[model samples]
Target: MTEDLMLLQEKVTLLRSEGKYKETIEACQHLLEWGMAANDHKSVLVAHLHKIASYYCIGDIEEAFNNIGTYIELCSIYGDELDKLNLNNILFLLYEFNKDFNKAKATLEVSIALGKKLNKYIIISNGYSNYSHIYCAEENYEDALKMAKEGLDTAKLLEPASPILELRVKLNMAKAYIGLENFEASKSLIDEMINDPILDSFIREKSNCYDLQGNWYSKQTLYREAFESYTVAKNLVESYNDVYLLKAIQAERCKLCDLMNDVQLGYLVQKEYIAILNQISNRELELVALRLNIKHSITDIEKKANTDYLTGLFNRKYIEYTANQWLEQASITNDNIVCIAFDIDNFKSINDTYGHLFGDEVIQHVSKSFSKKFGEHDLVGRYGGDEFIIILKNISLSDGKIKAEQIEESFKSIEMMKNGLSISITASIGVSDNSGGSVVTFTDLFQKADVELYKAKLLGKNQISCGS
Candidate 1:
């Protein structure tokens, strides 16, 4: 039965990869039924994950959001570490699509932190690539460049890198360069992607590349070249049948037509846009039916999911949301937003030596101290296990570092006793802030804090590391 389920799930994945979202949704119905009958939590989670993505791909963002709440609850209750990580990753895309850039950045930050803990390099690379895409959408091209370069650098570290995903990252880089008005750099990258054989195999992505090529040409007022590029893109989408991409290409073409006052081009875009929108409307009706058929019979899973019930602190999701708000406010006010990460040193050893109950006690003990010392801050939360994160608003880096040191010193008294043996708990601390004056999101700041946390672990533990 397990083997059958795995094979069926693989089929669904392949179909989705091939852009057969309708088929993917159809397959998910069977998969979800089988998963529920077998009481397989993970399989049910994946079925919903794919179903939601299929809905989004087919231009039903509202349904995606509707289903996502249940999905997140399932993840919170039954998800493994990796399952929860993937949840954050998808939330990043959903938030991005909704134009909630602050929330998007926060989710990506959580995703990156989880990926690093699990050594999921692909997830980390994807997170950075997504950051670049978000910045590109915001027209903050320099930060987009920074993020894309980081993504590429991380991708290079993979033993056998994902070629197609790498190209997509490069595609984002090209768009960023164009937005920055670096025509020469943009053209060089675009030409490289256009010539890459791997891109030819993915018609939908190739169409996108051409659409971007059209934009590039239009940006420079090269109307003939732009028109030719848009023509190729339109034809490819005709074959690929991605209504969303088709509509977007038409929208771009419409702007180009208006720019040049080309009546023929304007008519062409109007015709294509209406045609694609109609196709989308028809497909959405069908998928909406499938959603009604296959949605899991679950309800009220979203109750207080933002709280870590074990310690009565805000959970990762809420922490990210709150910090993102502060980060946004700081961006406008030119104030600093700082974050600190704390990991209980030798926590596993304590779990092994003293009982699981003692370990729980230690966590509660430390969490209490956090509340007393730093509760009146921007955000405070538990990032699972024996780790906690605190966000300080409108604070300088130096001041934040001092607070971290003070917290570290305070932890000396936070410990539990077992049978006359008294052991004190010490933690490795990492502090990061927006003092660099370049970061536009919480993810940027969190990444630096995470790195500094690693540094503290490397520096013999029980020390404080602050990013410059």
Candidate 2:
């Protein structure tokens, strides 16, 4: 089985290397299924990572974003600290590519925080470089230069050193300098980049240097030189068949065309540019439809996971999770937090007197009636077969009692003919509040409400009992 998984992974790698992105995605799906069946979480995580890469390579950033959630979940469980740092780095770059600069910065912060914790100076340095890149994207040149300076200093702390990484940082710093109109400083860096043997080894980097040269020339009113520089960059990008770089180079040409006011030149290049841009737009639109479908599927899965099968209300586990969050947040505000518990009166008798199916109808009917009386902010959950719990925030205890009483009354008034079976129901209610820390946690508050519910049952079946 392990051998089979390894061979499958190799196939995925080969397919991706061949630019068979769609096949690669399909193979990754099988890999996930196989790994999950064997409980091999590491392989599962690897599959998710590869799938994300495939999606990103195909320019499906939305799918990449969706898959990141599950990857983070698996990574947290099975991946190491270095794995986490890499995840942060990948997430930062992913967000950056998606043009979500704020989220990119946020992910970089996570990378930096983890790097600091692990004393991994390389991660910190790369993190600073990413910050510079993000700032440059936002046209915040001063901050970009600051981050680039920091990246440079941090790179020095690396024991062995990464010349390539340092080179990339310098490129970013140079771009920042260009943005700030420091043409001389930019020219110095650009000249160094053009002369560097390392850039010779990297076609994309070399192309980018030429692109920057065009920018420098254009900004200095050197249109003829800028046009030549852009041509060189475009030819290099075309040689590499880099869609992203080609698009950027073409955009620069578009601006140049307008500035030069050369109608013939503009028409000659812009047809291809428009075609590529339209391809991207069409691809994005198709993905938008796919994204909506995926989103619906995800929502259905979440609903099944979190809601009770019988009544379509949140189950015990989800309620516990959500209630705990509310309890944690309650300290931020002194607003009254109420926990209401209730059980259908004589539920066992109802099930025995009628059929269990009819009893189900009763439960569903009561749930609908009970939930509809409360606002969306109220948390409603089926705590047990016949019991329900709700949490309401920013409401007075007296208001909570009134709401509970209303729900009890609502159950008394509703009749349901589910599957041609008729039933009427009422519930005994209990109410408790953390107005002054009478209960400190969700469990404590729910138990207090349960006690009040017991009192309501002792006094009479269909009634509300408030904590006294």
Candidate 3:
């Protein structure tokens, strides 16, 4: 029965990963039934937790809250201190998401008490970090910074440093530093985060690091550097599918654009930012409707409406939104911003010869490969059919050329298999940066890059061209 339950759990995980949220909930229900029948309290708790996660993923927050209640009740009857502590943390997040800051703070207090009772340094450290986040959210920068320092101090007592917990603490501390207008300290923290190997796989944390750096630059009146930082943060959030962070970053970009006197771009980004907020609001409404057992009509639009369907990259509208923000930032700071435009060489012939499906495979393969060659902060988007554009922030013209060459080389090594036949793909890249005296708006920079791209194609497909 244990082995069967384990298999069922795996199935639930797989379903969730595949975005089959309804199926995942159904599987969890099946597991719950089995666990209850067998008198296995732990299994029952696990099943309920899984169901809660699935409901949350599906944006059915009311269902998640109900399951969380059930989980908490079960914990009361059969859980240890650690279990209760963990459940309280989850409750804290749910309340935070719902904007119930008072309740969230109360729950965090309970978690801290539980951790103290358990005498677990890690839990205590996590509690401090979460407390710092709350304070930071409330704009109490000094208190937040102090809490983060306490969290770090607690974490230092662990035999081996808890990288995940430490990272969280550092992130909160960085944000606090930004809030206090300590730009240099905030930048140092972000630089440390970027160089930390443990944070490499934690895309959100790394993204936050860049976001904080952007905020620092913004505070210092270095609008161009701030724009570059924000662009990188936005790209990372998009890549990670973090809608909440994306909305926040977009909002910041809108403000920055307005400050730069680019009212048109500001309005466009503001529109997108409001749309994301509405989506979040609708999710909250769904949660309320669920609690009342009332049916709510949810729009069936794709979650990433701004992204290209095939490559999962930003579509033209979002690219315009980000590019406009970057260009405005560059104009003010006189900082360097580069645009790289590229397309698959002979893409039409490949589509004609190998069929559209294989051509799509090539596009996906190249998109993945090209995206990997750049940092998480750099913006990469599918401009149109075969064309892709990248915004390289804070990079010199010489470096942009070197990076373009590297991308071209990377594309040359891509092999896509169809019908057991191996197909090699290549791309022509054009590089242009704001370092060129005449480049002004994003459109101008992109046009310059496009000209270089045309040169690359004319000089023989698979090569790179750079604009002076």
Per-model C-alpha RMSD? 18.8, 7.8, 28.2
Pitting candidate 1 against candidate 2, the one with the higher TM-score is 2
TM values, all candidates: 0.55, 0.63, 0.55
| Candidate maximizing TM-score | 2
Q: What is the C-alpha lDDT of each candidate?
A: 0.83, 0.83, 0.81
Model 2 stretches astray by more than 4 angstroms = 1-121, 124-163, 173-203, 213-229, 235-247, 254-264, 280-302, 325-333, 349-355, 394-399, 414-426, 435-437, 459-464
Per-residue CA lDDT of model 2 for 278-352, tens digit only, reads 866777787667556545654665677679999988898778877777777776655578989999989998889
In Å, residue 345's CA in model 1 sits off its true spot by 65
lDDT: worst 10-residue window of model 2: 290-299
For candidate 3, lDDT tens digit of each residue in 1-468? Answer: 988887887887788788776667767777776776577887787777767776776666776797797798899999877677768877887888887878988988888788778778888888889888989889999999998999899888888767877888899999998899887788888888878997678888888888888888888888778877998898888886677888889878988997788888778778878887888788778656653432221111222545889998877766776777887877788778889999998999989988998888888888888888887688888998889999988889889998888888787678787678877788889998876434567788888899999999999888899987
Model 3 pairs in collision: 232-377
RMSD (CA, Å), candidate 2 to true, equals 7.8
lDDT of 2: 0.83
C-alpha positional error of residue 452 in candidate 3 after TM-score superposition, expressed in Å: 95
Q: lDDT by residue for model 1 over 1-468, one digit each (tens)?
A: 788889988988999999887778777767876786688887889888888888887667887788789889898899998878778877877888889999998998898788788887788888888999999988899999999988888777777768887887888889899999999999999998999899768987798799989999998998778978998998999996777877877887887788778998699779878888988898889877755644442211222455788898888876876677777777778878888988999999999999898899998889888667775555888888998888887788899998898788778766567899889899999999887445667677778898999899999999899988
Q: How close is candidate 2 to the true structure, as a TM-score?
A: 0.63
